[model samples]
Target: MPDPFDPSPDSGDRFTFGLWTVGNPGADPFGPRTRPRIPPTEIVAGLAKAGAWGVNLHDNDLVPFDASPTERDLLVKEFQQALADHGLVVPMATTNLFSHPVFRDGAFTASDAAVRAFAVRKAMKGIELGVELGASTVVFWGGREGVETDAARDCRDGLGWYRECLDFLCGWVKDQGWDLKFALEAKPNEPRGDIYLATTGHMLHFIETLEHPEMCGVNPEVAHENMPGLSMVHAVGQAMEAGKLFHIDLNAQRIGRYDQDLRFGSEDLKGAFFLVRMLEGTCGHPAYDGPRHFDAHAYRTEDVDGVWDFAAGCMRSYKILVARAAAFDADPEVQEILEHNHADPDGIGPILAGFNASNLAALEELVLDPDSLATRGHRYERLDQLAMEHLMGARS
Candidate 1:
């Protein structure tokens, strides 16, 4: 019989990693790089060997930021050969608008018109690269699109500039007839004092205001959401509910800290279990069918072997969480509690379904005992304890 705890991943799992993630050199703001850089080709080979379905990247992750046209082509050709040789694929791509000094102020929201134009132009090239690599989604992480103070630029102008940039890019993609979509990643702060569209919910609402709302979605990172002491599961659920969860970044982070980007399911085990349940729809709902991309890196204290270990651990943790979540949802006790909590014995659902004279009348005529309702315990404590047991392998 197959081991229930087996952690081996396969292509069918839809697991992916970013070149920048696995290839990260372990550099932090307080120290120099501890690990040597791993070339893009080598990264691809390693990921395939690790049983990853696909890889992702930023424009600068493969080609140099200052490389000439000929150099860029050669680099891309070599990377493509490596991917083909290893049976790996590119699922997503992004731009590095933050790294360059040109975006010191901001990219799309830059006060300098030339800087904004250059940012858009660079995004166009990044989009072309992504489509060429067969990526259906391009993520935009506006790392520097914020201000240290309100005096830097008017918030209204910044929003208008951002809108214009996205509108232009959407039109460009449509004109080229490329099968691509944009996933905006949000961060409360880090590279900047405060970032625009600071959370997944904010991104969802912002998407609706875009000229090509349907062509835009959000890429929620676990670490990014947790940095602000928010619930990653709720953020993701909102995105999924709105049908805007185009892509996701699986990693861990401690609350009230920098973006740690630790291994998946490392810090918030309970949160991770719920997140897996939501994504896999183990609790009875449609699952999110998208690449489970790990946008994380190894610790600075590790060597090359440790890096690979970190990679494997991320996938292994996710698989384990998935199994646990399934077990939790399938538990008979859990099922009973959920059914009881969700029981609409009074049949108030149909009446509350819409707003109309008849429905309003039905709702108005409804008789209920508030004291009885308040006195009835939901048994959430028991349900939560059951979940923990499942997650900890205490119950199966």
Candidate 2:
């Protein structure tokens, strides 16, 4: 890796991984686990050795589903020991609410009161782990928070239930008085036919209805945004502009498809280019200082070694794009185009003052003639070609 502190740099200690990514074993709805189930500590150790700065995890990733309280303590103890030995930390934690069969109907919007209560308790446990591990935030991806058919329940009720659950969780965080925050991961669909709060804008708007809206934000996932055929860069840009980009999930997906969870930069390098440029301040925004957490999983075709490669590749692709972004900014043509579009501080000073009725009326005939003024169009194709060339280091 190039030294990040150097005058010219490529990478830095800004990469984090989800423990589930390295341990997924390439499982899917149609398939079983292909690789052996590795222990939690080993996963953390492997990620550390593979160059991950830290990790985030779903609650069940480290502890067994039915782990006793004593067992939970032992597991957290071992996990913390591994972290101390490897110099790693947990930046975020999430509850695995969509996996269990009980959540088939939904967690927060379950028809069964008992099931809904159970989901809430499970989330509280997730928060407990986050607090114990000193996580900066807890993420909630409502994978099954909606229904398959319109006959099942009103979507309004689902949204209301979601807000209610969030209100409780946010209040719980405050009552605990820990310096932790919560993020809502918006997925268009997958485990369920439709997911409530299925986009960045939906969740951001929903937060306003909550009593503790200030405690919640969105952790927009790239693949999720791409699944709905939305502009991934624009979605992230909106989150950052709203100060609700509490965390991020970096991954790849083909346009208008299932959630592939492919490795970052696998399918859309250009989209990743603009996304990284946004985070790196190549656009006129402040650079994001939060964790670049990879919430992606390995392909079902991959083996154990492939899993590690996918994990490392997330950071590698991000660094390469950062370099490309710097190159894009320093290019003279790009600077010229940006400057041409920029509103100069001096304003159209004397020009606006000269737009009096007399001269304006005298020039009406010439101004009204379409052929009199030549069109000055934006050379967007040229700019796009420039970006592509720089992305591939082909600026010869």
Which tens-of-lDDT digit does each residue in 1-396 have in candidate 1? 855433334425888999998899999989999999999999988988877889999999998989999999999999999989998889899998999999999999999999999999999999889988999999999999999998998888998899999999999999999878899999999989998889999888888999999999999999999999999999999999988999999999999999999999899899999999999999998899999999999999998889899998898898888889998999999999999999998789999888999999998898888998799999999999999999999998
Alpha-carbon shift of residue 238 in model 1 (angstroms): 0.6
Model 1 off-target regions past 4 Å? 1-11
Count backbone overlaps in model 2: 0
Model 2 worst lDDT window (10 residues) = 2-11
Find the candidate with the highest TM-score and give its number.
1
Which pairs of residues clash in candidate 2, taking residues 3 or more apart in a chain or in different chains? none
Give residue 218's lDDT in candidate 2 (0 to 100). 88
Worst 10 residues of 1 by lDDT: 3-12
